[model samples]
Target: MKNTPIGRLRLIGLLEGISYLVLLFIAMPLKYFAGFPVAVSISGALHGLLFVLFCLAILHVMFVHRWSIFRGFWAFVSSLIPFGTFVLDKQLRREEA
Candidate 1:
Protein backbone atom coordinates (compact mmCIF):
# COMPACT_ATOMS: atom_id res chain seq x y z
CA MET A 1 0.00 0.00 0.00
CA LYS A 2 0.89 3.66 -0.24
CA ASN A 3 1.12 4.15 3.54
CA THR A 4 -1.25 7.05 3.51
CA PRO A 5 -2.82 8.00 6.82
CA ILE A 6 -6.07 6.26 5.90
CA GLY A 7 -4.23 3.23 4.66
CA ARG A 8 -2.15 3.04 7.81
CA LEU A 9 -5.25 3.38 9.94
CA ARG A 10 -7.01 0.61 8.05
CA LEU A 11 -3.98 -1.62 8.32
CA ILE A 12 -3.82 -1.08 12.04
CA GLY A 13 -7.55 -1.72 12.24
CA LEU A 14 -7.15 -5.07 10.55
CA LEU A 15 -4.26 -6.09 12.77
CA GLU A 16 -6.07 -4.95 15.88
CA GLY A 17 -9.29 -6.67 14.91
CA ILE A 18 -7.73 -9.99 13.95
CA SER A 19 -5.46 -10.06 16.96
CA TYR A 20 -8.33 -9.20 19.23
CA LEU A 21 -10.41 -12.03 17.82
CA VAL A 22 -7.58 -14.50 18.06
CA LEU A 23 -6.70 -13.55 21.62
CA LEU A 24 -10.28 -13.57 22.79
CA PHE A 25 -11.77 -16.54 20.94
CA ILE A 26 -8.72 -18.80 20.73
CA ALA A 27 -5.92 -17.82 23.08
CA MET A 28 -8.01 -16.99 26.11
CA PRO A 29 -9.99 -20.18 25.88
CA LEU A 30 -6.85 -22.27 25.51
CA LYS A 31 -5.31 -20.57 28.49
CA TYR A 32 -8.27 -20.59 30.86
CA PHE A 33 -10.05 -23.74 29.81
CA ALA A 34 -7.24 -25.89 28.48
CA GLY A 35 -4.54 -24.70 30.85
CA PHE A 36 -2.14 -23.45 28.21
CA PRO A 37 -0.44 -20.31 29.44
CA VAL A 38 2.37 -19.84 26.99
CA ALA A 39 0.24 -19.37 23.90
CA VAL A 40 -1.97 -16.91 25.73
CA SER A 41 1.04 -14.87 26.81
CA ILE A 42 2.39 -14.73 23.28
CA SER A 43 -0.94 -13.75 21.79
CA GLY A 44 -1.49 -11.20 24.53
CA ALA A 45 1.85 -9.58 23.83
CA LEU A 46 1.11 -9.43 20.12
CA HIS A 47 -2.30 -7.88 20.81
CA GLY A 48 -0.70 -5.31 23.09
CA LEU A 49 1.74 -4.30 20.39
CA LEU A 50 -1.02 -4.04 17.79
CA PHE A 51 -3.15 -2.08 20.22
CA VAL A 52 -0.39 0.47 20.72
CA LEU A 53 0.08 0.73 17.00
CA PHE A 54 -3.66 1.15 16.49
CA CYS A 55 -3.75 3.96 19.06
CA LEU A 56 -0.88 5.78 17.41
CA ALA A 57 -2.43 5.24 13.98
CA ILE A 58 -5.66 6.77 15.24
CA LEU A 59 -3.81 9.86 16.45
CA HIS A 60 -1.95 10.13 13.16
CA VAL A 61 -5.21 9.79 11.25
CA MET A 62 -6.81 12.48 13.36
CA PHE A 63 -4.19 15.00 12.32
CA VAL A 64 -4.00 13.86 8.73
CA HIS A 65 -7.74 13.76 8.34
CA ARG A 66 -8.19 16.95 10.33
CA TRP A 67 -10.73 15.32 12.61
CA SER A 68 -12.22 17.34 15.41
CA ILE A 69 -11.31 16.61 19.00
CA PHE A 70 -14.56 14.76 19.48
CA ARG A 71 -13.80 12.27 16.75
CA GLY A 72 -10.20 11.82 17.76
CA PHE A 73 -10.98 11.37 21.42
CA TRP A 74 -13.75 8.86 20.84
CA ALA A 75 -11.74 6.86 18.35
CA PHE A 76 -8.76 6.69 20.69
CA VAL A 77 -10.89 5.85 23.70
CA SER A 78 -12.70 3.06 21.90
CA SER A 79 -9.54 0.97 21.52
CA LEU A 80 -9.55 0.15 25.23
CA ILE A 81 -12.64 -2.01 24.90
CA PRO A 82 -12.86 -5.38 23.22
CA PHE A 83 -14.14 -5.22 19.60
CA GLY A 84 -13.87 -1.45 19.69
CA THR A 85 -11.32 -1.32 16.89
CA PHE A 86 -13.66 -3.22 14.61
CA VAL A 87 -16.35 -0.63 15.20
CA LEU A 88 -13.86 2.10 14.57
CA ASP A 89 -12.89 0.32 11.38
CA LYS A 90 -16.46 0.51 10.13
CA GLN A 91 -16.54 4.22 10.84
CA LEU A 92 -13.21 4.79 9.20
CA ARG A 93 -14.20 2.82 6.14
CA ARG A 94 -17.41 4.78 5.82
CA GLU A 95 -15.48 8.00 5.93
CA GLU A 96 -13.02 6.79 3.30
CA ALA A 97 -15.61 5.36 0.99
Candidate 2:
Protein backbone atom coordinates (compact mmCIF):
# COMPACT_ATOMS: atom_id res chain seq x y z
CA MET A 1 0.00 0.00 0.00
CA LYS A 2 2.82 2.38 0.80
CA ASN A 3 4.60 1.64 -2.47
CA THR A 4 1.73 2.75 -4.71
CA PRO A 5 0.49 6.33 -5.05
CA ILE A 6 -3.20 5.50 -5.27
CA GLY A 7 -2.99 3.03 -2.44
CA ARG A 8 -1.19 5.53 -0.24
CA LEU A 9 -3.78 8.16 -0.99
CA ARG A 10 -6.63 5.74 -0.35
CA LEU A 11 -5.18 4.86 3.03
CA ILE A 12 -4.74 8.50 3.88
CA GLY A 13 -8.29 9.24 2.82
CA LEU A 14 -9.64 6.44 5.03
CA LEU A 15 -7.66 7.69 8.01
CA GLU A 16 -8.78 11.25 7.40
CA GLY A 17 -12.39 10.14 7.17
CA ILE A 18 -12.15 8.24 10.43
CA SER A 19 -10.61 11.25 12.11
CA TYR A 20 -13.40 13.45 10.82
CA LEU A 21 -16.02 11.10 12.21
CA VAL A 22 -14.27 11.04 15.55
CA LEU A 23 -14.11 14.81 15.65
CA LEU A 24 -17.73 15.15 14.75
CA PHE A 25 -19.29 12.42 16.88
CA ILE A 26 -16.85 12.20 19.76
CA ALA A 27 -14.75 15.32 20.18
CA MET A 28 -17.40 17.89 19.39
CA PRO A 29 -19.90 16.20 21.69
CA LEU A 30 -17.38 16.01 24.48
CA LYS A 31 -16.67 19.70 24.06
CA TYR A 32 -20.24 20.93 23.92
CA PHE A 33 -21.91 18.53 26.30
CA ALA A 34 -19.22 17.63 28.79
CA GLY A 35 -17.40 20.96 29.01
CA PHE A 36 -14.23 19.33 27.71
CA PRO A 37 -12.76 21.55 25.05
CA VAL A 38 -9.46 19.69 25.03
CA ALA A 39 -10.83 16.81 23.00
CA VAL A 40 -11.93 19.09 20.21
CA SER A 41 -8.59 20.91 20.25
CA ILE A 42 -6.62 17.71 19.84
CA SER A 43 -8.95 15.98 17.38
CA GLY A 44 -9.42 19.16 15.36
CA ALA A 45 -5.69 19.72 14.95
CA LEU A 46 -5.04 16.16 13.79
CA HIS A 47 -8.02 16.21 11.46
CA GLY A 48 -6.83 19.47 9.91
CA LEU A 49 -3.40 18.06 9.17
CA LEU A 50 -4.83 14.84 7.80
CA PHE A 51 -7.30 16.73 5.66
CA VAL A 52 -4.52 18.80 4.09
CA LEU A 53 -2.43 15.72 3.37
CA PHE A 54 -5.45 13.98 1.83
CA CYS A 55 -6.04 16.95 -0.46
CA LEU A 56 -2.43 16.95 -1.59
CA ALA A 57 -2.62 13.21 -2.21
CA ILE A 58 -5.75 13.67 -4.28
CA LEU A 59 -3.97 16.22 -6.44
CA HIS A 60 -0.95 13.98 -6.88
CA VAL A 61 -3.07 10.96 -7.86
CA MET A 62 -5.16 13.03 -10.22
CA PHE A 63 -2.11 14.39 -12.00
CA VAL A 64 -0.27 11.09 -12.16
CA HIS A 65 -3.30 9.16 -13.39
CA ARG A 66 -4.45 11.87 -15.79
CA TRP A 67 -7.90 11.79 -14.20
CA SER A 68 -10.54 14.24 -15.27
CA ILE A 69 -10.96 17.54 -13.46
CA PHE A 70 -14.46 16.48 -12.46
CA ARG A 71 -13.19 13.26 -10.91
CA GLY A 72 -10.66 15.16 -8.83
CA PHE A 73 -13.28 17.68 -7.82
CA TRP A 74 -15.65 14.94 -6.66
CA ALA A 75 -12.88 13.25 -4.73
CA PHE A 76 -12.30 16.48 -2.81
CA VAL A 77 -16.02 16.90 -2.30
CA SER A 78 -16.34 13.31 -1.04
CA SER A 79 -13.98 14.04 1.85
CA LEU A 80 -16.44 16.56 3.20
CA ILE A 81 -19.18 14.04 3.94
CA PRO A 82 -19.35 11.25 6.51
CA PHE A 83 -18.08 7.91 5.18
CA GLY A 84 -17.59 9.62 1.83
CA THR A 85 -13.99 8.54 1.43
CA PHE A 86 -14.92 4.90 1.85
CA VAL A 87 -17.47 5.21 -0.94
CA LEU A 88 -15.14 7.11 -3.19
CA ASP A 89 -12.29 4.76 -2.44
CA LYS A 90 -14.43 1.74 -3.32
CA GLN A 91 -15.41 3.24 -6.65
CA LEU A 92 -11.81 4.24 -7.28
CA ARG A 93 -10.60 0.71 -6.60
CA ARG A 94 -13.08 -0.67 -9.13
CA GLU A 95 -11.93 1.88 -11.67
CA GLU A 96 -8.29 1.07 -11.06
CA ALA A 97 -8.79 -2.66 -11.13
Candidate 3:
Protein backbone atom coordinates (compact mmCIF):
# COMPACT_ATOMS: atom_id res chain seq x y z
CA MET A 1 0.00 0.00 0.00
CA LYS A 2 2.86 2.33 0.79
CA ASN A 3 5.04 1.59 -2.23
CA THR A 4 2.78 1.68 -5.26
CA PRO A 5 1.50 4.64 -7.28
CA ILE A 6 -2.10 3.52 -7.00
CA GLY A 7 -1.64 3.17 -3.27
CA ARG A 8 -0.28 6.69 -3.03
CA LEU A 9 -3.11 7.99 -5.19
CA ARG A 10 -5.70 6.21 -3.05
CA LEU A 11 -4.24 7.70 0.09
CA ILE A 12 -4.24 11.15 -1.44
CA GLY A 13 -7.81 10.79 -2.65
CA LEU A 14 -8.98 9.80 0.83
CA LEU A 15 -7.23 12.73 2.50
CA GLU A 16 -8.49 15.18 -0.09
CA GLY A 17 -12.04 13.89 0.18
CA ILE A 18 -12.04 14.09 3.96
CA SER A 19 -10.62 17.58 3.89
CA TYR A 20 -13.31 18.63 1.43
CA LEU A 21 -16.03 17.23 3.68
CA VAL A 22 -14.55 18.88 6.74
CA LEU A 23 -14.37 22.19 4.93
CA LEU A 24 -17.96 21.96 3.79
CA PHE A 25 -19.79 20.41 6.74
CA ILE A 26 -17.64 21.41 9.70
CA ALA A 27 -15.48 24.42 8.88
CA MET A 28 -18.07 26.26 6.85
CA PRO A 29 -20.64 25.89 9.60
CA LEU A 30 -18.13 27.02 12.15
CA LYS A 31 -17.46 30.12 10.11
CA TYR A 32 -21.10 30.96 9.49
CA PHE A 33 -22.77 29.86 12.73
CA ALA A 34 -19.98 30.24 15.22
CA GLY A 35 -18.43 33.38 13.71
CA PHE A 36 -15.07 31.68 13.52
CA PRO A 37 -13.55 32.64 10.20
CA VAL A 38 -10.25 31.07 11.15
CA ALA A 39 -11.67 27.61 10.73
CA VAL A 40 -12.50 28.35 7.13
CA SER A 41 -9.19 29.99 6.55
CA ILE A 42 -7.21 26.98 7.74
CA SER A 43 -9.48 24.29 6.42
CA GLY A 44 -9.82 26.02 3.09
CA ALA A 45 -6.07 26.17 2.68
CA LEU A 46 -5.64 22.50 3.59
CA HIS A 47 -8.41 21.44 1.25
CA GLY A 48 -7.02 23.50 -1.57
CA LEU A 49 -3.58 21.98 -1.18
CA LEU A 50 -4.96 18.49 -0.97
CA PHE A 51 -7.12 19.08 -4.03
CA VAL A 52 -4.14 20.18 -6.09
CA LEU A 53 -2.23 17.14 -4.97
CA PHE A 54 -5.16 14.97 -5.92
CA CYS A 55 -5.18 16.45 -9.40
CA LEU A 56 -1.52 15.74 -9.78
CA ALA A 57 -2.07 12.21 -8.56
CA ILE A 58 -4.69 11.73 -11.23
CA LEU A 59 -2.26 12.83 -13.89
CA HIS A 60 0.37 10.51 -12.54
CA VAL A 61 -2.06 7.66 -12.53
CA MET A 62 -3.06 8.47 -16.07
CA PHE A 63 0.49 8.08 -17.23
CA VAL A 64 1.48 5.20 -14.99
CA HIS A 65 -1.68 3.18 -15.12
CA ARG A 66 -2.75 4.25 -18.59
CA TRP A 67 -6.15 5.36 -17.40
CA SER A 68 -8.63 6.32 -20.06
CA ILE A 69 -9.87 9.88 -20.29
CA PHE A 70 -13.29 8.94 -19.01
CA ARG A 71 -11.85 7.18 -16.02
CA GLY A 72 -9.72 10.16 -15.14
CA PHE A 73 -12.68 12.49 -15.57
CA TRP A 74 -14.81 10.43 -13.21
CA ALA A 75 -12.01 10.50 -10.67
CA PHE A 76 -11.85 14.26 -10.97
CA VAL A 77 -15.59 14.64 -10.71
CA SER A 78 -15.78 12.24 -7.81
CA SER A 79 -13.52 14.47 -5.76
CA LEU A 80 -16.11 17.19 -6.04
CA ILE A 81 -18.89 15.08 -4.54
CA PRO A 82 -19.30 13.97 -0.94
CA PHE A 83 -18.17 10.36 -0.30
CA GLY A 84 -17.45 10.05 -4.00
CA THR A 85 -13.80 9.25 -3.68
CA PHE A 86 -14.46 6.32 -1.38
CA VAL A 87 -16.85 4.87 -3.90
CA LEU A 88 -14.42 5.52 -6.71
CA ASP A 89 -11.66 3.94 -4.64
CA LYS A 90 -13.58 0.72 -4.55
CA GLN A 91 -13.90 0.80 -8.30
CA LEU A 92 -10.21 1.49 -8.57
CA ARG A 93 -9.42 -1.53 -6.41
CA ARG A 94 -11.42 -3.77 -8.69
CA GLU A 95 -9.58 -2.28 -11.63
CA GLU A 96 -6.25 -2.94 -9.94
CA ALA A 97 -7.06 -6.58 -9.53
Q: Model 2: clashing residue pairs?
A: none
lDDT of each: 0.83, 0.91, 0.90
Q: After superposition, how far is residue 87 of candidate 2 from its true place, in Å?
A: 0.4
Q: Write the per-residue lDDT of candidate 1 for residues 1-97, one digit (tens) a residue.
A: 3468877887787788789889989999999899999878999999899988988888898888898899988887777667887788787777777
lDDT of 2: 0.91
Q: After superposition on all CA atoms, what RMSD does each candidate show versus the true structure? A: 1.8, 1.1, 1.1
Model 1 regions more than 4 Å off? none
lDDT per residue for candidate 3 within 1-97, as digits (tens), equals 5557787788889999899999999999999999999999999999999999999999999999899999899999999999998997888777666
Looking at model 2, residue 45 earns an lDDT score of: 98
Question: lDDT, candidate 3, residue 63?
Answer: 93
Which sections of candidate 2 miss by over 4 Å?
none
Candidate 3 ranges beyond 4 A from true positions: none
- Model 1, TM vs. native: 0.85
* Cα lDDT for residue 57, candidate 2: 93
How would you encode candidate 2's per-residue C-alpha lDDT over 1-97 as one tens digit per residue? Answer: 4457788788899999999999999999999999999999999999999999999999999989988999999999999999999998898777666
